[model samples]
Target: MKLNIKPFFIAAVLFFGAFTSGFAQDNLVNSLKLNASEKSKDSFTFTEVINIENTPVKNQGSSGTCWSYSANSFLESEMMRNGKKPVELSQIFSARNAYLEKARMYVRMHGAVALGEGGQFHDVINMYRKYGAVPQSVYTGLNYGTDKNKFAEMSAVLDGMLETIVKNPNGKLTPNWDKAYAAVLDTYLGAYPANFTWNGKNYTPETFAKEVVGVNPDDYVELSSFKEYPYYSKFVLLVPDNWAFDQVYNVKINELTETIDNALKNGYTVAWAGDVSEKYFSWKNGVAFVPNKDFDEMTVQEKAELFNGPKEEAVVTEDMRQIAFDNYSTQDDHGMHIVGLAKDQNGKEYYIIKNSWGTTNDYKGYMYMTKEYVKYKTTAIMVNKKAVPAGLAKKLKF
Candidate 1:
């Protein structure tokens, strides 16, 4: 089923940065706190229509590593769905491994690649397939005299080192530069363990990943919807954080939404990447929606109603979504897990999203995102290939 939406003139909303690091969370929380009075006026209520069992919310404190946290959480849910014991996998292990690889690429490209705390869902899967994973208890990535993940000082030092290397001061690059870089990572994020014991058994990262985690990296597929790309074909998502340049299968907007609905109905969760900078995205109230009226045109009551409950949403069209992408309004900003479905007081549907910002929001680290918001702001989603409908899977070549 295709949506025949048409574009119309609407007041523009300001664009914000895409990456959700530890600093960004602090700012978001502060902003929400300041708007407490406005949010308190709302009267929104949600009834859960579907809920998937998953692990507790985690805090990626002082780190820009939501990509790893959300992907690992999704894998934990997959394990539960598969009848395996749910384990809190180490997010930093993957982050550390990916960081090293990314640093290598940055230097190889003469510092042209983006280097920081942003990544795609595919990064976690690729890291698992290559370096394997460890339980969070096994590796917390807190080696720098702190109990939480913090990378500010470490990031500056690494960036400086890379910049110096890119300059080629000696006219001939040193073969041990990679070793030097690895040393810095090891000093901060801790060295990768060659082997470790868990549950009274000894295993290497590879064996543990295969025998215990038991997730097939290939079993998952990343999908997106954009009018510029041919339907049923793959294209590289042009996001800066996608340093690895992963390809996503492009489908019509309706097919993308239908796939998400089908996945949740079948007890599967999704890893979502999208923009969260809209005027109606109220993290404090635990609601995100695309209101029908423009921000400037809305009356005080209408603005309050937006957060209090579901309301009529703007008609999001292919051109509108594409324009947002083209003009840098819809950014690849944050990564989250969509675990369930909910309906507002008026029976409008919303995806129950699990965030990695700890339990601070009205829903305790979870938010209800309206279908219109998802349709308009989404960058992409990663889902278990089996969860996709047979028809859509065929189109995706899965």
Candidate 2:
């Protein structure tokens, strides 16, 4: 469904910032910076069928802002895909702006909606459209005394303040409440800079966005497949972190993978959000595929050999996908970028996923997710409308 809305800030569910010095320079190691023996012994070796260049891997330390990191990484790739110079956008700036808006919404809803660090892919688009963009250097948002993001305390404090406002002992709101909220964010993230110098030039976030970033926010659309919603109709996704209640368009299950394959084949990357909570989703080995046998039923040897390479996987049917979603096996657990496609020794297809968790995995923070895993666990995807397949585009009225 690309209705229009798009969490964790990945497995609590996963995101990206690219091209500064470390990861950015490291990204040029190979298309994926693979070691000759990147895979474990007996593990699958992938030859990339389509490798779209993107910025380096990012580490979203101690925070659940993967939605921002992943979407911004997709946007960075989008910039590269369009021939713009690579620039890493600030993931935390989006987080800063979103916290303000989420607090306001929480008060409006009388504290009914869930509010925290988790968000969907479209939250980045919403922030970009509303506040424009800035380079990561312009607003690193590490002002709270750490070299990396650690949101546990800050988010809790912010939530506590919002809950107090919702209590409304005065039975009325004060104009300065939001101002106080902004001050707290400022204290932590530093004020969203009014203007900043970049490449020896002065520009505000909006100008930098228009002149440098050059992304057309409206060109992107969010989509998901759910049996509960009618295909091709716009419906607001009911997931808890989608506090804004943004809409998404629903479609048949196979169309989900078909659309992603078409986009990559045609030189576009996808912002993938879905369940990464499965036991078979081995982030360390950088491979994920559904086993034909259930996890609990697997023998010890079968479990040990799970990530050793390619194997037959259960054929995911529409009913099977629906069952996972209905029973909560499929959830909005993490977000990642789908950069390319690859196949194992047996010729099965896997999507090359760029994760935001850093280079801890075998593929240097890049991993291979079987198409079956994506089709079964995907909650939503936000992709450029121009990349939409021609026939499917018409069917969804894109």
Please give the clash total of every predicted structure, in order. 3, 25
Query: Which 10-residue window of candidate 1 scores lowest in summed lDDT?
Result: 1-10
TM-scores for every candidate against the unseen true structure: 0.92, 0.90
Model 2 C-alpha lDDT versus the unseen true structure: 0.78
Q: Which stretches of candidate 2 lie over 4 Å from their true place?
A: 1-42
For model 2, residues 1-398, the per-residue Cα lDDT tens digits are 11111121111222121101122212222212221233453566678899998899998776667788889999999999889999999999988888788888888899988666777888889988898899998898899899877666776678779888989878899888889999989988888787999999999888888999999999999888888888888899777778788998888889889899999998999999887657677776788888899977988777667777787899898888889888867767678899999988888899999988788767888989998899898989989998888887898897
User: Judged by lDDT, which candidate is best?
Assistant: 1
- How many angstroms is residue 155 displaced in model 2 relative to the true structure, after the best TM-score fit? 0.8
What's the distance in Å from true for residue 118, model 2?
Answer: 0.7
> Which stretches in model 1 have alpha-carbon errors above 4 Å?
1-22, 32-42
Model 1 Cα RMSD, 1 decimal? 5.0
Summed over model 1, clashes come to 3
